[model samples]
Target: MIFQNRSRCRENKSIFRAGNQVLQHTHEYTYLGLKLSSTGNFNLAVNELKAKAMRVFYMIKNTIRHEIPIQTWLKILQAIIEPIALYGSEIWGPLKTQDFSKWKKEAIETLHTQICKSILKVNRATPNNSCRAELGQHPLLINIQKRAVKFYQHLKRSDPSSYQAEALRCQEQNRPRSTLSQLMLKLQPDQHSTIWPNQIIQLQKLNDITYWKDATKSQKKMELYLNLKRDYKPAEYLSCVKEHKVRKTLTRYRLSAHCLAVERGRHRQRWQPRERDCVCVCVCVCVCVCVCVCVCVCVCERERERVSECPLSGCRERTAPAEVAAERERLCVCVCVCVCVCVCVCVCVCVCV
Candidate 1:
């Protein structure tokens, strides 16, 4: 018995109906066989069962479905199905007993080998080609390379435990090597610092040597502070040198020392006061004072002139000069004559009485 293909049968209703009828008949016959098996029709029952099994097989064949790909399925199925196929007979037998420990050990070993091989393959396949041809040709690369060599030598001398023997061996073998500067140029900015600190130091040293020649006095001082700060943490180094009690004193000393140096440098250099500025301030003050003095003098002169021009006697009308003089003399003489008359009257009265 064969099941009809869905695609081929879809276009023909008669074919689809015929396939459905066949499936129904197979189910009915299989059910009838189960019902009749208790009766004496054992041969007929066996034939019906075979027919139903054939129908199920045909259905599966025509399905063409997959959960896993064929290759993966074969590999996985070999592990699962092989054991079961080999042990199926023993598994059902009353005398046979299962041993899971042996099977588990075999499976673990197989998985471990597979995992290790996969990791090694992945590691081997990673590309290590560099894109630093231009960097290799740089002029500074040689100097940086020398410095890196020296730094590595220092590291080896200072602490052999910290330096990897393999890396040091590689450096010794590869002489006339390109400096880390070239390598750093190929790396990201953040990666450069972590990858090549010694190279960075050499580059900075080169810059400083050049800067010392051309930098101004103030710039040199600033560079000194920057270098110190870069090499040592300000708070930690200061704390180490001076205890808490003397921290402020140390800080003041440092600040005063720097300030004095700056002041001394300024003193050594020629610095003239701005003449225009000084003259402007002096002229402004002089103009203000002169204006105030002129105003005061004018006020005093005006008051003096007003007082000198004021008439003294309010009763005097317009009078001739000679008449004024004669009146003045007559008034004086009359005052004298009255005083004598009073005196004589008093004497005569006294004598006659």
Candidate 2:
């Protein structure tokens, strides 16, 4: 008898139900170390895998041999990181969306920026491809693809009378290529779609007798893909380098902008008070913004994504070199009020007693 280890992350009885009724229902269950959600998406499993990989990577990095050779570290990664991160990858590998924007950025970011770069003793400035190449480690995405291809091959090679082969046949009838057609298309060396025509033909035959059996094709394809001459695609290479540059530039820009904003906010907070002040001299400056008859409503729209930025957008203080300041006398220690209104907006004025 086989025993499956139950995980603490197993799905629990439903706390909610439709039609304003509560029913004892379990939307998901854990079996064989996999978290299968009701939606049938690998999101939960993928998140778990990432958490496991990160924990294992850190554990090995610090607790174990402190100063291991790069090659040894690579071996350690393949042993621990791969098993954790790539478990059940064949099922959900191709299910990933092409758009990285919607992905859980933290999961991939930690893997790429921290684990992968630290493994190679490299920094974020290094190109992604260069980092993987220098480390002699396969890209996480590549390994997942290879697993998918292998699994497809296994399903094709299964017993003809088995349900697995029957399911493969059903999948073939529904689509010309496997579900991963788009993923494979992206991995194609050229922009042409017909490059993998033979693979497509075999997918059509998935329902029939498993005649096509070039099991090592995925490996060959990956090796060729990696070894392809990049000199021919100078523009693509430049674009990749430019992508890195853009990301770095954006990071620096955001940092400087954030620092300036924080400084301005601190200055504003220091000058301003929490309690409302009474302005005895309230100057109502209205610049006759299109006086309409019976309809005094005015519409003035400005496109600003971050309109709440500091120094107050409408009240930009500009003092030219030729401009002279008016002579002023210091007031005695007495209660006073100051109000200056401009551009149809009241400036918050305050005077200390």
Candidate 3:
């Protein structure tokens, strides 16, 4: 199949022969596990890779419980899944031009983030940057680009007489839209500069892998710390937690990914408040009522869902009964100005904070 931008040659029927037999012209072909199409579009190939990677990802996720350490999970992901997803990234990596490259990169990013969330036993709502920072993991795109850059470096350092080196030179000279050309454009090499620094060395210090990894992680963590400081929000609990480990746990709690959050969700799922007997029952039936300064009455019933408007003019906000079961419940009356507390009943506890 022809790999050109235009399909004018396709209109004319062409035939090829190999010895005594006729060679078939197929629209698509898979060679060395990488799919190639007549239109030269890499989207299909990327989709295939993502599908394979996801299958493996799920298998691993199901196989390994959260009992494993974060470092071990990271190792499994980087070793098993990344290789599958980024199999031919070195070849198609440069094709990721901004507006045209959303799905290609997003798929990999999603996989990486999901794995990270699973590793931390965090909720899906956690911010991607926070997860990456917590785990000290670089973005998957960086890894893919690094692979591409290293591949280029390898080709550059190959024997000049080798076909790969010859092809590299030829492509640089003739093919402006080629992978090498695109990578060079992205890199923005200086024309006036003669002496080229080793891309491999400049990209990362590989002589000591452990040191390099640690340094990279530290850099990432420092950047995250600076970002957090810039966007700081004072929390009461944070002031009390002086230990670094305790602060880390508090940060996770703030992000809604801590064990408390998980347990809260589980509790909500298990004990659903009846809609009819909802404490903030705006309409009719009295489920449970507590005679306090700020009275919260809930009439919770099975499979009932409706919005409960506050009868009191003081309480402008209206809450759903289903939400009262799933989330927090607020009082319709003016009980307290600033302080909010949780109330545990005889059967079910309506936790509001």
lDDT of each: 0.36, 0.49, 0.59
Candidate 3 weakest ten by summed lDDT: 296-305
Off by over 4 Å in 1: 1-164, 178-275, 305-353
Best to worst by lDDT, what's the order? 3, 2, 1
Candidate 2: count the clashes: 0
> Can you tell me which runs of candidate 3 are displaced by over 4 Å?
6-12, 18-22, 98-105, 174-176, 185-252, 256-353
List runs of model 2 lying over 4 Å from the truth: 1-23, 98-113, 121-130, 176-353
| Per-residue alpha-carbon lDDT of candidate 3 for residues 1-353, written as tens digits (9 for 90 to 100) | 65657555665367778898988777778989988887887777887898898899789788865454455667788899899989898887677642212532476677787777766556776665556655666556666667776787789889999999999998888767576667655554663543333563344323223333344445433443444432212333444555646665766664545566443564464653676346443321132223342242332322122333423324436444465534443433233421233233322343431
Models sorted by TM-score, best on top: 3, 2, 1
Better-scoring candidate (lDDT), 1 or 3: 3
lDDT of 2 by residue, 39-121 (tens): 56667887888888888888777886545555566777778788888888777787874333233253543474457567544
Instruction: For each candidate in turn, give its C-alpha RMSD to the true structure in angstroms.
Output: 40.2, 20.4, 16.4
lDDT, model 2: 0.49
TM-score of each: 0.21, 0.44, 0.55
Top of the candidates by TM-score: 3
